[model samples]
Target: MRLLIADDHALILDMLQNFLEQEKDMEIVAANDMQDAISAVSAQPGFDLALLDYDMPGMDKLDGLRRFMENNSAPPVVILSGHAARDVAQRAVSMGARGFLPKSMPAQSLLHAIRFMALGEKYVPVDFLFSSDQADASPAPDGPSATALTARELDVLKALCDGKTNKEIARDLGLREPTIKLHVKTLYRRLGASNRTQAVMIARSWGIY
Candidate 1:
């Protein structure tokens, strides 16, 4: 498969390129930032897949999807991030990315996720599949206050905790993106989370997710 990888880190770029080169059927097109990735995708043709870093200098987050969409190339983009929160993963998938893989995942798992995504499959972290009952088994200190979110809000927050974007959260919950965005703002205020990562960290610490 013809593959492109965009990451700001040289070591990661080189390592991934070298590793994928050993596969014999893959070709590497490299980019160090979101802009470079976008340019590479636009200039080059017939890329079977792309691996994008969410925190690349130019992209910094979910912005790469806007550029990808603007370029009109949907080559099964996979978001690879160092701080792969549930909200980011969900958001990447929602923004039309083919898959989401954490940078911390094992190399084999990353490869497996990429290969599976290439075939139009979805992947979720095993840790995220647990039921809320299990997740919230620890009793809330003040009962409702500790678990204050309404069921829908909690659902939205869980998706956020999973690194899902507002659009993705909307899709997953069958709500409008605007509505999800509202929920997210409310969640941020309620949880004192300034960003998705912070919200997730706070929730985990509070045993809310």
Candidate 2:
């Protein structure tokens, strides 16, 4: 896989580059800031993925992600941050970021997340997605907010967003298929959505993905 990773911190760039390059068939290029990242994309032109630091120079919060998406026929973009809030991560996903990766996350998980996003799956850590400080998240949902949804319901919502079938979600969550069905029913009612697509759309609007 080809990747473009940009951050202002040299140590982070080195660490990521060195670690990721150790895997076979992985090619990585690094840039120091958002402008440099854009320039690198312009020069290279067809990276498979791009990891952008959330607060680097020229990254006026999510404006940089918006600009990057607008500027290039870009690959999937994931935000890399050390301390971005839950609401910020949710907004990033809402703005079309493939995922958000906390700097403190385990490197193995980071690799998995990168691959997951590269494969067209959306990603955000569960804790980050369901954090306590969600003041910036979308206005409270009409039917049920995150507070009203159980953790298992949240998992079902995310699986729906992933386009997983009830059986598939059941297997992944280690629940019986009938139990998964029950969760789906609850998710639909609580999300005020009548169908899977509608439920996913509502969830995305609430930053659930």
Candidate 3:
């Protein structure tokens, strides 16, 4: 398979390239940023897959993911990020990403995810989903204000505090992206806050983490 991998970090880019080189059947093309990734994909239309860094130059967060989806004919463009928040992975999948791989993933698991995505299957870390579920099942801490938010909303809020995008929160909670947006809206209204930062700050003040 011919893969196009883009990341601003040279060490990561080099490490991934060297690791994938062990696969005799895989041909790797490298890029430093989203712009270079787009140009590389444009130049090599036959690329089987593209792995993009979540926070790379020329695009922010999922913007690069959207740009690649719109510009490339390639199937299964995967996202690689240092922050592998469950919601982020889900959001990427919702936005036409084929997979989400954490930078901290074990090499064997990373290879497995890549190969799985190459075969047109979505790959999200099982541990992420499991942890999300566990969090949901855990008891809420004592706080009268906490009662205003549902368990799921609290999940969303915690993700927001972690700087997760809406799609990521939805993915973490196994809800639709639109549903996550609605939750955020309701959360803001309930908290009497204007935005994510305000909501997080208010929640923190209320002893709700």
CA lDDT of each prediction against the hidden true structure: 0.72, 0.82, 0.78
Give candidate 1 misplaced runs (Cα > 4 Å).
Answer: 128-209
Clashing pairs in 3: 87-168, 88-168
TM agreement with the true structure for every prediction: 0.60, 0.66, 0.62
Give candidate 1's error at residue 138 in angstroms: 11
Tens digits of per-residue lDDT for model 2, 133-190: 5555544434447766757678888999999999999899887786677667656755
- Evaluate residue 94 in candidate 1 and report its C-alpha lDDT on the 0 to 100 scale: 83
For 83-149, candidate 1 gives per-residue lDDT tens digits of 6556667777888787777677778756655665565545544333222433333333342243456
> Which residue segments of model 2 deviate by more than 4 Å?
132-209
Worst 10 residues of 1 by lDDT: 128-137
- Regions of model 3 farther than 4 Å from truth: 132-209
Candidate 1 backbone clash number: 15
For TM-score, candidate 2 versus 3, the one ahead is 2
